[model samples]
Target: MTFSWRRRRSGRGGDGKSEVFKGINQDMELTIPTHFRCPISLDLMKDPVTLSTGITYDRESIEKWIDAGNITCPVTNQVLRNFDQIPNHSIRKMIQDWCVENKSCGVERIPTPRIPITPYEVTDIRSRIVAAARVGDARKCQELVGKIKDLAKESERNRRCIVGNGIGSALADSFESFARFSVDAHVNLLKEILAAFTWTFPLDEEGISKLKSAVSLRCMVWFLKSENDLSSRQNAICVLKELISADQACVDGLMGIQDIEETLFHTVKVPICPKATKASLVIIYNMIKSSKEKSGEIALKFIRMGLIHLILEILVDGDKSVCEKALGVMDSICSLEEGRENAYENALTVPLLVKKILRVSDTATEFSISSLCKLCLGENESALVEAMQLGAFQKLLVVLQIGSGERTKEKVTELLKLMNLCRDKVDCVDASMGFKYIKRSN
Candidate 1:
């Protein structure tokens, strides 16, 4: 009997039943086993291609599945392709079954797993995110959130890997995708990625150096831009705080931006909310604190730009917390040689600071007074004498006497001593204010 297996036709036989046949016309025809049929092609598989599209069987057909991970066959609706390129022994078995069942000319089909999408895939995500954002599809926009999270986790792992390998430069290229996507997306994920990058600090000299470069670039963009959503702003500020430690270059890079100074002054004066005002003040304080040691040049630049007067304005407006922070910043600025030189050149910062102290109500006078005395007595004997002449002595003594804290009293006494040292320049009325208070108490 000839086992014809080349062509089959659907028909009803004489028995009145439907018939199925593999082939009908030729002798010695090879019948392809069910397993030999490509799950996707449902034919003898040829030129099998493993593509990243979640399709693994035909090079031509699977190319479309490359990015589509684990796609079902369009014809058979079977899970015919694995796009991730992750190795699975079970998938090997499926390919093996096809090889065993086919009985034509011997053809070896090697399954070449697809190459993974490079980290550059983040750009694709960024484009999609922008499109989703444009259409106001919060759901689609939110979907990118998961991808961003995955990217972030992948970036962190890569960073640790690079650090462990002592290939810090590797991390720089690794995170380029995350950084590029972050800026393109212009969302909170940028912050998350930045935070992850920063978490790898002190990894190695090279890694730390690369981190500084990355942070400087990111912060420069954030600080220089005038337009960003509140969440973006918050994220940028949070990252700034993280990268602030022991990175003078990064701190100066942030401070060197004109927009940061403008944003700060504008926001403090015309805040969108009290919370925003407070947050901005806190960021400023943190920036100052970060640059406290190596900030002399930048501090002087800001002073020359009249930042002191702006801060003084905030203090005089009764923003007690903000005022206190501004005062602390002033103390930091004046303590530095460059800052003092700038203050002397402007010839306004000391007087403004002293005036702020004198104007502060008695209830909140202690911190302001201490901050002023620290700024004035340190370098400007002349400014301290001017402060005493402005009735600052009376304010300081009153704070010393009635203030609940011993530190306040000690700070007041120290200011009096500094003032006494400059008694020749101080007016007698102002000079005697402290003694008169002391006599009354006696």
Candidate 2:
């Protein structure tokens, strides 16, 4: 295959420090080579990695070489980075040999090395940024910050090089490396970095602890206090979730803040991606559930601050997974009898619980319907009667008949039994109608 080259030169001095290089324009036409094709694959070099013997190159090795900036095949000394950049003589011979060796094989071209920056360089810069961040040296920190930002912008400009790059991982690693300095750095600068690459926090076990220790809750709360944009605030919540999971100390710190109730409510109310919302909910639920002191107070605060309504909204509108999670939260809140009774006395819990059940139409999943039924039954007998009066029995029966899955039918039967036990309190006609619907469906 043919290959081409473009050189980018940084306007800076010849210190090999030029940030720019002029390379081959991607639009230029080029001639193909023939003799350099692979014997087994009969294709141009792809992801060519140099073998341990230093003579043969394979696809995986080629990829590492490309990622590591060794673009030329050592044995052939052929430029393998771009198909069009290959010498025409080599291409012609490779094609002729391929045709002679395999009459049915079509010419396969290798992928071009699109990214200009090497992974090593990215790693180097990331290390320097972390080192600078460590000493709390303002000037070095600012310099590294500028470099990281420029690299990000450069990556954006070079689509070929930036695609599938490990930029996010590098950024998160750098942030964690600077954990010791996080408390000392300028909060505004930290906020800027947090805002710029908010989505880099990894959810896996390896990254969870590093993220928590590196970023303080104070810094996160600070950013949330200063920033009004929902997107940035959402990122803050994401980073916080990582920390909340890894460090109970961080969770306690967050809980001890002067106006944490407001902060928690604000975070729950913010419109965010579903994954982020789920993470936040898990973190909060775990924190509240595990706490020994004032746990009920925190639960009450969530309800008082209108977060319960938001949770219900998600339950009603979100997909099955989210609905299941919402149920878990409701279950947790109601597990504390005092909190559940208080919520009932305030007249907030029953209406929302009833709404969820009433919304369970024929389309509702059995798990969601069952969850709602379970919550209702856990409440006082008065609450169950009120829910039946709101036409929940009719909806439950519809779900039983038209719901798609086995779980749905199973829950439907369970709900029917529960409603029958409360038959004396429910409108007898509604109960009878439900019983007839069940009998007819069976």
Candidate 3:
């Protein structure tokens, strides 16, 4: 996006303002040349960029467009192969020359565009980061972190480049490698790694896969337990959050770590930040996502760590996102017998599950129903009584009659069948609606 900067803008009698833009006067609103205008802003492009689809726009406008999560070219609506936008140096030069020609009329030359760091350069710096971490050189690590921070600050493009060139994977590898160093060295190394993540180098799938090593997992726990560096701990949590969500394989590996339960519980029990809190919950969900046996074991550990009560606290006070994730973990934890027993014994459990039914999004509703099915599908009288008192039957009737998803409706049927098995004792949702218990649809 480099453009010549020799020209100057003409101001209105030393008012120190750009009154003339190329040949168009700002006050006059004269129709400027269309080619010089950025399609997005419909004004002259200070730094024009050309997309792969051959559409040119002002740098700021196009970058904002890409950042909005759009994958298609704005003008053509064609799918983009990548988010990379090429700098139209020639168009920029033309605009600058025009500015210089009109300088007598008060137009000012735009400064040359700042080039974002390339992926090759990013790859080189990231290798250096890993090298520094390998030797546990504190100063070198800090300097590399500073360099990455500058790259991330330069443009959104550089941030993408950082991820594309595999810096995220390198950081994960660094975390693992640093574990061989002394505790203080590893902690310092982790802090620098976290500093890089603050700019949010999005980890790619390959990176997440490579991060599954036992050493890396232990390092993450170590970070969560750090007493000295709160910022690094928060960043570590953030990194863990992204890393865990990337792959079930990574999560499955962390299962062997005996102390992970305590670490994850403490993380959730007293999160350093909202991001960390959400990450803590997400990591638990990852652990329980795979197998029912695994789920039961993890649930037992979570119960031991008082994860249930902590989740309830989070549910009540958390924002929609945290509440949804909390519900997700609750659903998994409640699937096993230990989880069910723990949940049934808790006073807040049934009521909170019912409260979340339609209070959150459809995903929350799904988890709530699933958890309820696990809790109510047995001869657990206490759970049944809680549901009856909490008006859960009425809610189920509303759900069925109002047309819930096919799968949720099936879980509701199981709930009713269980309730009617004790129909002689409790007044439940009347099966008189001729609602036969339907098998749950996958």
Candidate 4:
């Protein structure tokens, strides 16, 4: 198959990284050499890399093939003994030279590609990390972890290779061992360790379990305090979210830490990054979800912390996804009497939820509807009357007409029934005898 490169001006992408091979000039016609083209993509190779089968292709093309579980070379049909793709530096140089020669033709030189960190190198780093941790060499451990963090930040491929080599678990183990001693002298080391752990997200089961340990929890809690830097606290909260989600037991020990509740509340009350804020919300939701026995007690605790008013403020102008997560927290909170009362008392709560019914995504709509049902169905006809006044009935009709999930539809139907029942009691009441007397005067 023949491939054509689209013409475009060279510039950086949204990530602020230089655009690769996007500077080809279509107006100035020039024939690209066959050897300079990737066999898989049939396009000019941007980062030509030779595989074990002695055939060259673009790094992206080959990586995609291997990631799709292909074991054989695409050109030779020979089984790949290893996944290594060595950079064809000579060919790359020749390509650049050709581009320089054709400068009059508007040919742009392909930038030199950074070699991806190999698994072998990552394994070597892991070994040294183990040795350093074993000998209680905090200084060496810090240097090694810094290197690992740099590699992880370099590229997605390097991060994958680092995680595949079990660097995350190794770092966690090292941190635990070192934490057994005084960590005051190694504050920077602890910060680096927590940040490194955050970079290796979607952790394996072993990594999750290791992070769930008391030592790891203590370390995370220490950074979460208001005294630490924002980045350190952000990393700690992120890792804590992963651990708590993986195991419910993690939440028990985490909640027991002194000032942890205030720390988490402060983290949520003040925005760090979207990611860390979302993590904080998830942690709060999970805490409520896991402690079914004490769910009401937990809900009351958060309500006392001003969670109800705080989330109402979020729902006002938060993005669709954040609104959805915030609504989920509200749903969990509204499961209890105190939570429902707090929500009913908040003037923004009912109206905001009604607006979200058919406006946001289905997940958000579901949570909104569920929370609304809980609030209005409680020991007050006022919530029901206020909901109808906010045009909730009209929105529910739209939801039913357009159709929603079974659970959402059911809640909508139930809420409609309740509102329909409340209409008689609400509408019959006289609005104002003074207005009627004024009509008589007119």
Model 4 lDDT per residue over 22-135, tens place:
444545446667888888987667789999999999898999999999999999999999988899999999888877887665666787878889888998999899899889
Q: Estimate the overall C-alpha local distance difference test score of candidate 1.
A: 0.52
Each candidate's TM vs. the true structure? Answer: 0.44, 0.56, 0.75, 0.87
| Better-scoring candidate (lDDT), 1 or 2 | 2
- Best first by TM-score, ranked: 4, 3, 2, 1
Model 3 lDDT tens row, 324-424 = 99999999888777878887788888999988877887788888888988888757777876776677777776777777788898888777656665555
The local lDDT score (0 to 100) that residue 388 gets in candidate 4 is 84
RMSD of each predicted structure: 21.7, 11.5, 7.2, 6.9
Question: Residue by residue across 186-210, what tens digits does model 2's lDDT show?
Answer: 5555655565454343334434444
Give stretches of model 2 more than 4 Å off: 1-116, 138-185, 203-207, 227-231, 242-253, 256-258, 269-282, 292-297, 304-306, 309-328, 342-375, 394-415, 428-442
Ranking by lDDT: 4, 3, 2, 1
Q: Roughly what TM-score does model 3 have, to 2 decimal places?
A: 0.75
lDDT of each: 0.52, 0.54, 0.74, 0.80
What are the per-model numbers of colliding residue pairs? 8, 41, 9, 0
- The model with the greatest lDDT is 4
Residues 1-442 of candidate 1: C-alpha lDDT, one tens digit per residue: 2222544332423442212233233434454555334455464443354334344454334444433564565545666444333344455566665454552433244444443334455556655655664554545655564555454464343333333443223333333334445455544444444444444444455544555564445643563243555544544444444445445456556665555755665656565455556555655665665566663555555566666666666665646666666676666666666655655555555555656653645434555665566657666677677777777776666566566467667667777777767877755544344454442222
Q: Could you tell me the TM-score of candidate 1?
A: 0.44
Clashes (candidate 1): 8
Question: What root-mean-square deviation over C-alphas does model 3 reach?
Answer: 7.2
- Measured by TM-score, how close is model 4 to the native structure? 0.87
User: lDDT score, residue 344, model 2?
Assistant: 54
Pairs of colliding residues, candidate 4? none
